[model samples]
Each structure stands twice: as structure tokens, then as C-alpha cells.
Target: MSNYDELHRFLLNAANVRGELVRLEESLQPIVHSVEYPVQIQRLLSEMAAATTLLTAILKFKGEIGLQIQSKGPVNYAVINATHDYTMRGVARWDESLSVLPESFQELLDSAVLVITITPQEGERYQGVVALDKPTLAECLEEYFTQSEQLATKVTLMTDMSEPTRARAAGMLLQVLPSQAANTDVKNDTQFDHVCKLTETLTEEEMFSLPVNDILYRLYHQEEVEVYPSHPVSFACSCSKQRSADALRNVDKEELLQIIEEDGAIKMNCQYCHSEYVFDSVDVEAIHNGQFIETRKDQ
Candidate 1:
């Protein structure tokens, strides 16, 4: 298999618990290049990239999932978007006044919020918000799942800005299937506690660089794990000049003209891919008024 892509799911029949392993190398690193970001920001982007890929992989949807962080500190907004296909791209915005990077995810995102938005193509958009907790990105994700989904889930993400500028982010999720019931006397929490105990034994190297099978063996070799087919993860963006023109067409003619005069041209930049789309005066005029008296400029 290629070193840059893939997610594997494993299920243990007797325990009603399921797990997933995802390692993103080239898949997410390309996303980090979209904007000029600090090392800390790259780490956060890696974690969110992993999270979105894992979350969307489990969904039975045709649309996209967006993980966004909005902050009141140096970082204005950091967002990663992905789909069931695992195609992804991300970008972040920060305040210009900010110069130094903070100590941790929470430090960098002081007074910020993490929001997860799931947009299914044919249905409604669902969103969940969690206040930044603990020092790490993984902890914030666990909190979001517990509060918003009421699921007993644990997530561990590791980011390395070391030589080669490589990054690896992976996650393991466990929950008692609806049919599997815990003892009423002990509450459903005990099962989750037991799972967390086992899951905590996971090591950084196993998560960051190991293949799905090896990683699962390290974590759950004692149990019966049925591994399923894997899905490839990747860095992809859906943006183009035609789409930009379509967007520009939505604005009023006067507004488009005003924007052209002010900016010298109506330019739209895709945040995900860093692609530029420039509409000169004539292009802006066509888009605004929907007028097309076809006479080629060269003609």
C-alpha cells in the first residue's frame, strides 16, 4: 500500500466494540501548505484532518464533513473539510498582530471553540460545539464526542514537525453497540472505562507510523478482530474558475462593478487549494448582468 493513504476498521464480535486505524502522511501534509502556518497550527491541522477523515468514513453520506476551530486569540479560524471519499483540504486564518506561537492547542486557542459540522448531501447539516479543554487537540475531540454524542469515546492524535516535516495522525474509537447492554447496577460507564483502560496502552509509534494490522495487533491482539477493506485517504480540493464565476454572478451588477473598481479586478481565491480566479472588467460585466453578445475579443 502507498505510505500516504488508508483507513482500516476492525470489529470484535464478542465485545460489541469496534475500532478504526488511520495514518495520514502525504494525504494531510499537502493541506498544511495551503497557508503560512506555525508548527503548532500544522499540528492542529493534522489532528483535525485525521478526525474529519475518520468521522466521515463511518458516515453513510454523499456530502462532506467540516471540522472548524474559531478562536479569540492569534488564530482566527482553522478548518479542515473532507468527504466520504476521504478527499480533503484545509486552511487557517490568524490575526496579524499575533507573532509568537503559544504553548499548546488550548494555549493557542485561548477562549476559542471547536465546531464539527456534518453536511450530508440530501439532508440537513448537523453541528456540534465543544469548548477547548486539556492541552491537546485529541482531548478536545473526546470531550466533543462525549458531550455532543453522549458516546464513550477516546481519541489520540500525534503530530510531529520533526525533520522531513512529516506528520501522522490516527484515532481509535470504541463504543458499546446499541444492543449490547452493560449491567444496570454498574451503569453503562464501566464498559467504557474498561475500554479506555485497554486503549490507553496504545503507544505513539504504533499510532503514528504502523500499518493498520500491526497497530490493531498491538492494541487488541487478545480479542477477535475482523478487519474490513480499507479506504484511501487523500488531499483534494474541488474548486475552479468557473465555480468562482458562478459565485460572482450571484452578486448585483452594481456591486460587482464597484468591487471591480475597488480591487482593480474581481478576484476570488479558493481557500482550500490556494488557487486564484481573476475576472477582468469584461468578465465581471458578463457575470453581473448575465449578458452575452458573443463576439470574441480576438475576433
Candidate 2:
């Protein structure tokens, strides 16, 4: 069966290495088309969504993971947020005045910094930042793992934006298990490098079209892989009329009433999913009165 919108995890029992493969199809469409982003921005946002899924699978705790890139360049901000179950949503913003956008990652995000934030459901949140000095998103992620976790990691992020209406993205992650790496030997290190070399042979066609198992076999045909149950991934935005109302609670009631009086209603929009929520006088009054007033969600 096809592994579209699913994540598969595997471990090389003999080499003490772990791997994850994720492919996004239907889950990527809503995100890519959430706004009228340029081709470059679409590709970049897709890549980030794939990477966030791969990273979320590597975590042992149940929480949310956010991968963000910020810079003083053409693209000022981009972020992909994912939950432990692989539910994902993302958005990107770029300068519209520029006639041409850079085709390379470094050029598009000059002086950029990649930030990885993990917020556990029960524990304190953790965040790590690294300079986006590499030419590609994959390499910069590898640098992050090396610096923050002290482990050698390899990441491959690919996107198929050929069909404007049907975009796809996929990613693969390889890393050494910390528990099994207490006593690293030269032989084991060599084996890890060997496996990484094989992984480098993956092409865009195979990565985007082939099944997860098939791709793994093609790359690690000689290694003993212990595959785990696959997890389903989908596009889920954490936005709703109630959440929008909660945000409006912070604003002064008089100010909100003034806006409602002028416009007949207050409107809120979510950038991640292009969702619109409108609150009329009654809804606003109920909100201020600490009463529940259910309103329909606008798309």
C-alpha cells in the first residue's frame, strides 16, 4: 500500500542506528495553497513541513514541535508546527515588492537562524537555535543535531512542486541512538558512515514516488532493519471560533464594541489555514459577559 501522509520508523539492529521516513500528499495541499505564496515560498514551506514531521517522530514525549526559520532577508519568517501524532500546519511570508526571489536557500534567507522548539505536554519547553549557514535546509538540520544532541545526523528533504495544484513533500532522517552510543568504536562509526553513504544515493523520483519500505530496502538492502508500526499524518490547524474569541478577550471591551459598531462585526483570520471567524454584537456581548455563544466557522 502507498505510504502517503504516513511516517514509518525503523532501526538497524546491528548498526545501532535509527531512521524515519515521512511523505506528505493530501496533508500538504491545504498548507501549500493556504495563501498566494510564490513558487519559492511554497517550496520552502513544504520542506519545513516535511522536516517537522520527521523531527516529531524522533521525540519520545507527547508534545508539540515547532520548526521556525527567521532572517532579515527576502523571506522574513516561516514556521511549521506539528504534534506528537503527526498533525501538521505551516505558513510562510516573503517580501512582495521584490521582482525576483533567490533560488537557493542561503540566498533567500540571508543571515538566517533556524530555531527548534519542543513543548512537552507535562514538562518545561525546550528550544535550540543554530545559524542557518548551510546552503540547504537538510544540512542546517544536521548541524543542529550535532551541536545540540552531540550526535551525527543526516537529513534529506525533498519537494515535488511541479503540479501547482498537487504539491508533495517527503523527508528522511538518520541518527545514532544515544543509549547504544555510550561506547562508540571506530568499527561502528565506519558502519554508520557506510549506511549514510547508501542513503545519499536516494533520488527525488524514488523519494517522492516509492513506498517507504521500498525506499528503505533500496538504501539499506544489506542492513538488518526492524520496522515499526506506521503513524498517520494529517493537516490540522488549531484554530476555531472559540480560540479566536479567547484572543479577543484581551482587547478592551470598548474598543471591540467600537469596531463592531463601525463594521457591524469583528473579523479574525488565521494565516495558517486561511480560516475566518466573525463575531457580531451578540457574540461580542456574550464574550464580554463570560457567556458561551457558539458561532459558525468561516473558511
Candidate 3:
């Protein structure tokens, strides 16, 4: 089987262009298998995961990036989050019993809005929003780059579910670098168009099965490319008992006590990791007294 859970970056030696390729397997299985998602939802989640990974690689700061889709159609919402370390998690809410799977973005979502958020560890957070008017996620993302970043960008995403046990996703991104006075003779548009056209030749099978170097060679054999070391990607959730306890403290005291009295305890579930934090009367009392301690249970 082809190696997964890896991200590779490369630069076109002759053109002012850079690119990234990412393949996901183990990192994606837990997210897709966390709940019983239909094949269509599963595939969209995989693509979102791959797109998140690609976007995370391009960040210049230490932060977390998130891609979220909100709609009024069969698919209500979908989101994927990735940190600078490449840890990723995602989920989608949808109508499960739909008779037919959507064949296009417009079919799957109504009045859809795509939101991209970036929060740095210290600096201010940033957000960009765009309409999901395009047919594919790749085209929508490409529009974001053009409208928000003013850069010529191309994105290709693919997911393979042929294997029963493992679902795989892979994507590639190419962006034109800013022009420099020293290279005024190089036509940025021509270079970007050429590289983008070559990248368009990649097939789903090649994206999922070929190694990064092999794929680059196959696509740009006539050009000089400088490949970089691969970055490891994995599925990791940042949820913890302490975080859950802190969140619980924000609830009204009377409501907390009522829940404790009615159900014996107040349970908080982390949607990202599916971890549960149970707070009994004692814990609630401590929290009310500003002496709360972290307690956890895996569900």
C-alpha cells in the first residue's frame, strides 16, 4: 500500500511557483469512522481534511486553521480543523436518510457559505468567507485564493474508498509566488498557467498511490523541481478534562445543580475527540466554590 499521513512541499526551480502534496490514511480513518457517515459525507469530510492539511502547510505562523461549511440543504454543516503541528479532526452534520447522494455542491447544500478561520497562538485571529457556488471543493478554494489572497492558485483533491478497512485522501496545491524585480523577465501568469495545466493532468489513482517525488517527476519531468523533506501528519484532538471543566464553569449555577439532582451528574462531551467529562454533585459544588478539578471518562 502507498504510504499515507505525510505532506511534501516542492518548488519549481525555473518558475516562481511552489506546491504541496498531502496523503492521508490513519489520520483520516478515525474522523470518518467516528460516526456512521454516508459515503457522500465521508468523502466530503475526507476532502475537507485534505484541504485543511494543505492550507495548514502554507501558514507562516504558529496557529490553527479551520474550514467550515454551513448550509440549509441536506448537509447542514461540515468542518475540519488543523494545527501547525499537522494534527487534524473534522465532523459533518447531515440528513442521513436522503434517498440520493448529491452530485454537486449546489445539490448537496443550499445557500452554502464557506468560512475559513485562522487563529494564531498569540496574534489576532483572521477569517475569510466565500459562497460555495462552485461544483467542487477544489474550485471553491481556488476562488478563495484569487479573491482573498490575490494569488493564482490551483487545488486538486481526491478520496478513495475502494478498500473496506481504510479510506484515503490526497490533495495538491500550486501557487504563484510574488514577483521580484530581479526576475521581471519571467511571465508570472505564463508560468502559473503552465504549471497549473501540468498539475491538472494528475489522476485520482496517481494522487492516492504515487509517492510525492514520483508524482512531481511525472508531472514536471521537463522542469527542474526542488523537493523538500516530508512532514508527518496525524489525527489528534486537543480536548482535555481541564478544558471541559473550564467550559462547565460558565454555566448557570442553578442549572448545574438541577442537572446534578436530576441525572446524578452533568456530562460534557467533546465533539472533536468524543471524550466525555462527567461532573458529579461534588464536582459541581467544587466548581461553584472555584475549586474545580479535572475529571474525565472516555466514551
Worst 10 residues of 3 by lDDT: 179-188
TM-score per prediction, in order, is 0.87, 0.95, 0.94
- Write down the lDDT of every candidate, Cα atoms only: 0.73, 0.88, 0.86
lDDT of 3: 0.86
State candidate 2's TM-score.
Answer: 0.95
* Candidate that scores best on lDDT: 2
Tens digits of per-residue lDDT for model 3 on 1-299?
A: 55579889998969778889999999999899888887888888999999999999988899999999999998999999999999999989998778777866678888999999999999999999989998999989988887777777889999898975688899999887766223322245677778888988899878877777788899999988998888999999888777777787888888999998999888878787788888887887788789976644546
Q: What is the lDDT of residue 212 in candidate 2?
A: 83
User: For model 1, how does the per-residue alpha-carbon lDDT over 93-125 read when each residue is reduced to its tens digit?
Assistant: 876676788857767777888888888989999
| Residue 80 lDDT (model 1) | 91
Model 1 C-alpha lDDT versus the unseen true structure: 0.73
Clashing pairs in 2: none
Indicate the residue-level lDDT of 131 in model 2.
95
